[model samples]
Target: MIGGASAYDGTNCKAPGNCWEPKPGYPDKVAGSKYDPKHDPKEINKQSESIKAMEARNAQRVANFKKTGTFVYDVSKIPAAN
Candidate 1:
């Protein structure tokens, strides 16, 4: 059964040569720390722009497919059928 994100126990690193090491959690504890909003507006804007560009490209591809009944294929390399 699946549980919430924090339900599963993380790695145990009690002994030497173990991979796990304690790292500071999000909004890390520090002296005189000030809290800021988690989301970045600049990053969000960039992501939006990327999504719009992708949509435009996809529309263009669809239009091309409609114009040409034959679809593009890489005849040089064929995928293995399992």
Candidate 2:
């Protein structure tokens, strides 16, 4: 051991401050390998709908500006229920 008796155990670390093994009881598989949003059909559909809504809003804004010849600012109410 370079630093101390527990610094570089051959089964855990190579030398001082170098560890090769995962923490005890950690998952063996890689993170996000399962249940990733990119691989989920429902998540993909929801994301597609959100993107479509955004595009529609942008198109509406562009059309409004073209028709009125001025920029319109939509200020949301602080407490939307009001």
Candidate 3:
């Protein structure tokens, strides 16, 4: 009617030109590496670093709150811990 029959054909429709196709078992690959998902050491390290930074920031906020009865909403606003 409006667009065409392919528009209403759902997933069964075929593209006209060179269309992008998803790789098989793409979900199993997070970083697109052969040793991805199972052996993602780099990603794990990054997450651990992030967690450590968050923990340190929270500790700083808590110490600041204990000293002065105001909770810091932003980590950047928190004073440097000495």
Candidate 4:
């Protein structure tokens, strides 16, 4: 027998089953196909560089606002949030 109920039994599960099996990690890559960063280290580097640049830009904006009391993107033009 596969536990208590066949599945849903009207109000409750007459026979609740296990949630799911735990795997090492990843589903698509399990079939011996994984994305190796070694093959595209440059792309990885580019992604990292993009993140750093974004953080730096955000930091600069915050600093500018603290000093000049203004946002990098003009929110004054937009209607005030309700």
Among all candidates shown, the one with the greatest TM-score: 3
Candidate 4 similarity to native, TM-score: 0.43
Q: lDDT at 5 for candidate 2?
A: 62
Q: Which candidate is the best by lDDT?
A: 3
For model 3, what is the error of residue 11's alpha carbon versus the real structure, in angstroms, after optimal superposition?
36
User: For residues 21-75, what per-residue lDDT tens digits would candidate 2 score against the true structure?
Assistant: 6556655555565433355678769988999988876766666677667655452
Q: Which stretches of candidate 4 lie over 4 Å from their true place?
A: 1-38, 74-82
TM-score winner between 3 and 4, please give it: 3
Estimate, for each residue in 11-80, the C-alpha lDDT of model 1 and write its tens digit.
6657755656546564444434454446678987998899998786666555555666644343223223
TM-score of each: 0.41, 0.41, 0.47, 0.43
Provide backbone clash counts, one per model.
0, 0, 0, 2
Candidates' lDDT values, in order? Answer: 0.58, 0.59, 0.73, 0.59
| TM-score, cand. 1 vs. native | 0.41
In candidate 4, list every pair of residues with a backbone clash.
4-15, 5-15
User: Order of all candidates by lDDT, from best down to worst?
Assistant: 3, 2, 4, 1
